[model samples]
Target: MTNMDTLWLAPALVCYALSAVIFIAGRLTRTSRASGWAIYLLGAGVIFHALDLTARGFQAGNIPVGNFAQALSFFAWLTALASLLLIVRLQMAVIGAYSVGVVAATLGASAIMMKGGRIVLPASLQSVWLPIHVTLAILGFSMFVLASSVSLVYLAYESQLKAKRPLGPASERPPSLEKLDRINYSLLGWGFALLSLAIITGAIWADATWGHFWSWEPVESWSLTIWILYAALLEARLTVGWRGRRAAALTIVVFLVLVGSFVGVSLIDPGKHGGWFG
Candidate 1:
């Protein structure tokens, strides 16, 4: 069963790698078929990833999120899932390259951790809120990933426009600065809202199980900090109609802070949530 379950992941990783290449190749050649094919490949990858998660869940008899491997794999699935939902709508092939890379890397890490051993899901984590909190968190993180990648592209798009570069080949990809900024704003709003819900749900679960909430754990503190940073960015973008390099730069900074708070803090000194991913 373990061998069969692990086998579910191999095709997913390969498909992700293939999809990324196809997306990039499509962009370079300005071919619609490339984008179409890339999405198809990504769809296949998402399927295998989901199957891997399901197989692990069946083996564990739970959500398969007890430890690092499953947790990481779950988020990786969500990220790809998020991209799948957005790409067709956004029609932004370039974003696929970034999203696929993130998904592939996370999935790769999950595969590596699986080499250690399968996690024994702690009975303590068994609760209705586990899925709720994790689902929200993964969705929120996926949004942040999309927003940051869009911002990076925006900066490059803006720079190229500013430099008066010839449209020779560069025009084949990367949406206009205005469109990219709009996409960024849209992503931020959704990400912030989801993240807020994740925090609220986490607090509620804490109080229900632990008899209190707001423990000021490192994870909790950093989560709030991230919420605030994104909140400010959202407000400024909405009210002041801010755009351009500064907004893009701040978006990237917030993404880094997210990494520091979640991944970085987990590595050094994690609270309860540290072992999950940090």
Candidate 2:
């Protein structure tokens, strides 16, 4: 199973890395032709990644998120999938270029961790909610990643415009500020909904598995804090008409907190969810 899994993942990694390179080079060279080809390469990488994860699911008799490595790999797969879908809709290859490299880096980390040995799912987690909770959490996190990436681009573009600086080469011109802001809001809405579901399902799972609904575990506390933070951000955007630089900056900051909570807390602390890194 490991050997077969590696066979599919190897090509997927290659495709992701090559796509990022081609996209970056195209941007640097200010040529649309290379960027066009880069999109196809990214699509191919997503296909290969999907196949590898599907195979792993069958082999493991469950979703393949039994450890930190598998979790990260699944996260990369979902992020790449979301990026491809959004890039096609936005007709923006540059955004894909900006994000695909991060996806590749995530997969690379997963591959490195895979060498440690096979990871077994804890018996306590072998429930129907396993897929439900993990998928919702990871998918929500992926949307946050997309939102923050676009937010960073929005910030840079807005700063340049305010300074009356040139927008630079055609390849470097991100989507307009209004468009970036709208996309960020849309992604955040979706992420918030999914994250809310993930939290609820996790609570249910905890009760069934551990006879408790809420433990205030480190990861759980952090998750709730992230949820509240986004909720406030969205409320401000909706009620206070928050948009542009302030919105983008807050989105990026929220994402940083999420990363610290998800990765840092989950690995360092030994709470219920933290020790699942295997």
Point to the candidate with the largest lDDT: 2
TM per candidate: 0.91, 0.93
For candidate 1, which ten residues in a row score worst on lDDT? 166-175
lDDT of 2 by residue, 88-160 (tens): 8896666665678789899999988874445567677788999999999999999998998788778877998
Show model 2 residue runs off by greater than 4 Å: 27-31, 116-118, 166-174
| lDDT (0 to 1) per candidate | 0.82, 0.85
lDDT of 1: 0.82
lDDT of 1 by residue, 1-278 (tens): 36866687999999988998887676566455668888998999999989888877776667767676778788889889888887877777778878888888888888887744455556666789988998898889999998988887788767767899733454454577778888888888899999999999999998988888889988899999999999998788778977778889999999999987787777777777754741
User: Residue 267 in model 2: shift from native, Å?
Assistant: 2.3
**Cα error, candidate 1, residue 26 (Å):** 4.7
Q: List the residue pairs that clash in candidate 1.
A: none
> What's model 1's lDDT at 185?
84
Off by over 4 Å in 1: 25-33, 115-118, 166-174, 275-278
Reference-based lDDT, residue 143, model 1: 91
